[model samples]
Target: MCREPYPGRVTAPVFVLTPETVEPAGAAATAVAGDRLVLTGPEAHHAVAVRRLHPGERVDLVDGAGLRLVCEVTETAADGGRRERLAVRVVERVEEPQAGLQLVLVQALAKGGRDEQAVETATEVGADLVVPWMADRCVSVWRGVKAARGRQRWGAAAREAAKQARRARIPEVAELLTTAELAGWVRRVNDAGGLVLVLHEEATVPIGGVALPDTASSEAIDHPADEPRGGGKGPQDPVTIAVVVGPEGGISAAEVGALEQAGARTVRLGPHVLRTASAGPVALAVLAQRVGLWG
Candidate 1:
């Protein structure tokens, strides 16, 4: 729903204003036409110094939680490096509902930043969330403080990719998990009536041939509106589709067996095998097409 709908158009040079940035509870929710909003800190610096945005320019601001503000800049000032201010008058405010299908990427650790690249492209291809998995055959491992740093890097990548894609909502990066823990995750998703696909080269079924969840029918089931998504038992939540991508050495037989037992369907992309970095994105592209997300 939108106030003063623009009808089939949005401005460029988008900036994110997450809920954490807003002060005084409910301020953002109450914003209306002609209301002035200020932008400071790193985002303002990018708007003022890097982008050289001038007064009278149009830019879009998103809360990454489905709220988009079509605004016109009225002021821009830079004090120093990473210190600046940008102000805009809100023209229209829109509340976008979540998509019916949620795409999640479960990527295994790999050497040489391949895993990071995988997530970046997947985010660009419309993945809703990313999960880091320490597969049994992984060459790279995250331990101690390194694990936190790795997760932060992946989160940063997803944010940048979202910006490049002009996506209103940025994909979330989940906590790292081991193979055993991933099996439990698969079970939870399956128990909640979601689909989990494990990409394997030897699989008989291709990703295109695999049956996707019927979002139309899923939406018909009665459940509480406030119920959470993914692992929830509620049928009202959007159907989650998680794609599991293994490391360079591929998933071990034991790991595959465990995931299969947990209710994951193993599928292949095509005749040729893709690298760990490219497999997830390729599969996601196919799924996005099959599920009508691309349309």
Candidate 2:
């Protein structure tokens, strides 16, 4: 009943809805042909009033859970509250396939919200998850209540960025972690048959040739029950690409050693040192292509 995003129109407009608005996650939300999908509230207002999406135009609704409902605007009308809305007819529904390679970025917190900016770009570039790493060289600090707020801020940025990029899935933003915790993540990724790469300016190895784990993930995609990721061994698990980016002051030698010791491959992004805000996303773009996700 559902398929992937329409193969032809990559530029089709996409809008996000609350999890409760989608079925399986919530109640009575799945759509079918002839179903009237009343897109209202702020999202509809943005479409009808600001973006001027007229009747008969096509649009897509994604629930961030891989469900993409493709619909056509049937008519334009106003809600009881006087805001404009579009009455859409469900043409088809599709479930987007999960990314072949899970790209996770561990970014060291930087001053002036540079870290948050990095998450925004990373989400746009298809990072499945992100972690805020509080490294020794980081100028910013997150403690107690501040730590919770920081995580919330990063999550919000990811949501907005994913929406702007018209992605069907939004990347996750994890808790702020210490150096020791980062090492633990590397070990977990390694054990799960994933690749963990650290971005170090001084490293001699380039990210280009750092061979990823294996091609097992491509086969796992066809059989969801086969445990495509996590707590799996050999060809059954999906490969994870975790990139660690340091702050403005750069990573401490000790921190780098800790991560490397935990099975992270230290690779340089390029000849020039990149800003803490730009490094992780740039590395992800390179890895995405290398892994054939961009193809």
Candidate 3:
């Protein structure tokens, strides 16, 4: 039987295991209680040296793909070596279910680390996927090596935020998208019956008032089913909800027109204008509640 942990009483620090590390354990490895497991490498070093987690302490090991192992530390390296390892026994293995609605945040790259802040907050607020957008008025241009580095930074930020939030799944940071490419993506998602909302200060529709689609509908079209997200007993086709946030200079009218032409709905959050870093997270929180993700 699976041992249920106390609700709202999380006592252990979370350490994420990469897919490569967790996948080799196979599906049956952590299925039963009292299963022996070892946590090694950088994660273990951080747990022992940085966190000072001693034996008898509890910890949560997540694959960032729905698999979470609740473990009790049985032993720790006594030599205090830099490359230490931690051994634990699994108390329980839980496969977290996917959210009712898959939230996607398409944030335009901005200067002053504002884009990084946006993605970090969005991940903590339950955004399932994040896409970095190169807007027309973006002051921070990413080209060549800079683009790859920027995406890596964003992914790192999201991973840290997910760990802080104790999330079983980490949000994916997609490749950078130009305005035209973003429009194409919007069309593809729309064709799959997904909803895309572009945040505009001048829009007439309030984001809170938009009717959320029923994710339980079996007739819903599948959008990006190959996403690394795992853990569903049966097949489920959840509708994707994408929120677009502009850069520090704001979105250009031409870009807005292109997004609208591609079947995205322009919506306003409130009366006051928000900074680029705050807009997407706010919209995601509002939509998450409306779609029962908060429930």
Stretches of candidate 2 off by over 4 Å are 1-6, 19-29, 78-84, 216-237
- Angstrom error of the Cα, residue 243, model 3: value is 0.7
Q: Candidate 2's residue-wise lDDT over 76-195, tens digit each?
A: 776546476667787887766664557898999999999999999999988878988999988899999999999999998998788787777777777788999989878888877788
Best by TM-score: 1
Model 3: number of backbone collisions? 0
Among residues 3 or more apart in sequence or in different chains, the pairs in candidate 1 whose N, CA or C atoms overlap within 3 Å are none
Cα lDDT tens digits, model 1, 1-295, are: 1211334554378788754443333456777778888877677778888899999998887776667778899988776867687888989887666666788999999999999999999999989889999999999989999999999999989988887776777788888999889999899989878899999999999888988877654322333324454655554576889899999999999999999999999999899999999999999989887776765
* Whole-model lDDT per candidate: 0.82, 0.77, 0.80
Candidate 3 off by > 4 Å: 1-11, 19-31, 78-81, 216-236
Candidate 1 accuracy as TM-score? 0.90
Collision pairs in model 3: none
> What is candidate 1's local distance difference test score?
0.82
Clashes of each: 0, 0, 0
